[model samples]
Target: MKTKFNTSKFLAIVFIAGAITLSSCSNDDEDNNVVPELEVKTVEDLDGSQGPVFFSLSTGTAVQESATTWDIKFNSSNFSFGNGAEGQVIEGIFENYVVAPASGYSADDLAGIGSLYTYTGQAASGAQHAVLPTPGRILVVKTHDNKYAKIELISYYVGNPDTNSEAFINLETRPQSRVYTFNYVVQPDGSTNLK
Candidate 1:
């Protein structure tokens, strides 16, 4: 017995296969363009007297200052990049920034000295002398390993209290200082494409 070829059935199968292939290709493209979820972490009560609190953006955790894998450090209110690492504070909202710049990253000399926040002196902050995070300040950093990460300085006080509220304005009710809360994204691919 010989089997007969059905043209209509064969055409239908080919069309279906083509549609499935096109759908898969479209999904692949979408996946490539999708942005990764941002990582939010906080370093609590960094005391300069006790030394700096080192952090690793790649691992999204605080590391030992002496650890070779650390990427950045926080001493009191000051922060600095690890060896071979550099970064700058860009003026913009964190969510608005998409890609990291190609150049102009700094390691030390002036890494975290008033780069992300400003001091609300006795007369400046309405009887509340505190350090406040500057509005629209975003920190973009290049890890010591050459990977890129962008940071958003959230709060200098513990619990991330509302800075504008009366509770935050009152020095007695305000949260403790030296707490660093921020959101960051690390491009593990070592490319400037932060998306």
Candidate 2:
């Protein structure tokens, strides 16, 4: 009339549950090697001269996208870089007119470039803010979905370095560009504002 506790079955259930939980822990974020830190790399020989060179954050490839298709454009001024494409709007916050390598700072150092962007400057005035490329300038882009990415203009005209036209930039995009990595963000909370 009385039922006995099944320790063996109970242990088996717990083991199975734990395994499932651990297995699910691996998300696309991990499978794709996408971390919270910036996806750092240097892309050279990129010409943002005539029209903007289309760079896909999703695939990390630069293609010739017409005015109708592009992510960021390079101009003689600040408008040379930003989220100027479709999908998630990319915003740029002027960090410093002086460009410095992330390696130059301590691991915990977040000065100058440690701040967040609160304004979505007009696209017309987007990359239009002229900045002196001498010390090199750093722009923190609010990538798709308001996610953040920091980019430094290493050179505008290769080797000797000129302003605009052919430029090489050092980029540290965060997480992953996703399908169009630079084109979108994965915020499920539907929260469009960033603090």
Q: Name the top lDDT candidate.
A: 1
What does each candidate score in C-alpha RMSD?
Answer: 3.4, 14.8
lDDT of 2 at 157: 40
For candidate 2, write residues 96-179 as lDDT tens digits.
221222222221212222121122223243232222233323444433333333454443443423323222121121111111
The residue ranges of model 1 lying beyond 4 angstroms of the native Cα positions read 1-50, 111-114, 124-127
TM-score of each: 0.78, 0.34
Specify the poorest-scoring 10-residue window by lDDT in model 1.
40-49
lDDT of each: 0.77, 0.36
Q: List the residue pairs that clash in candidate 1.
A: none
What shift in Å separates residue 60 of candidate 1 from its native position after superposition?
1.6
lDDT of 1 at 140: 89
Candidate No. with top TM-score: 1
- Scored against the true structure, residue 86 in model 1 reaches a CA lDDT of 84
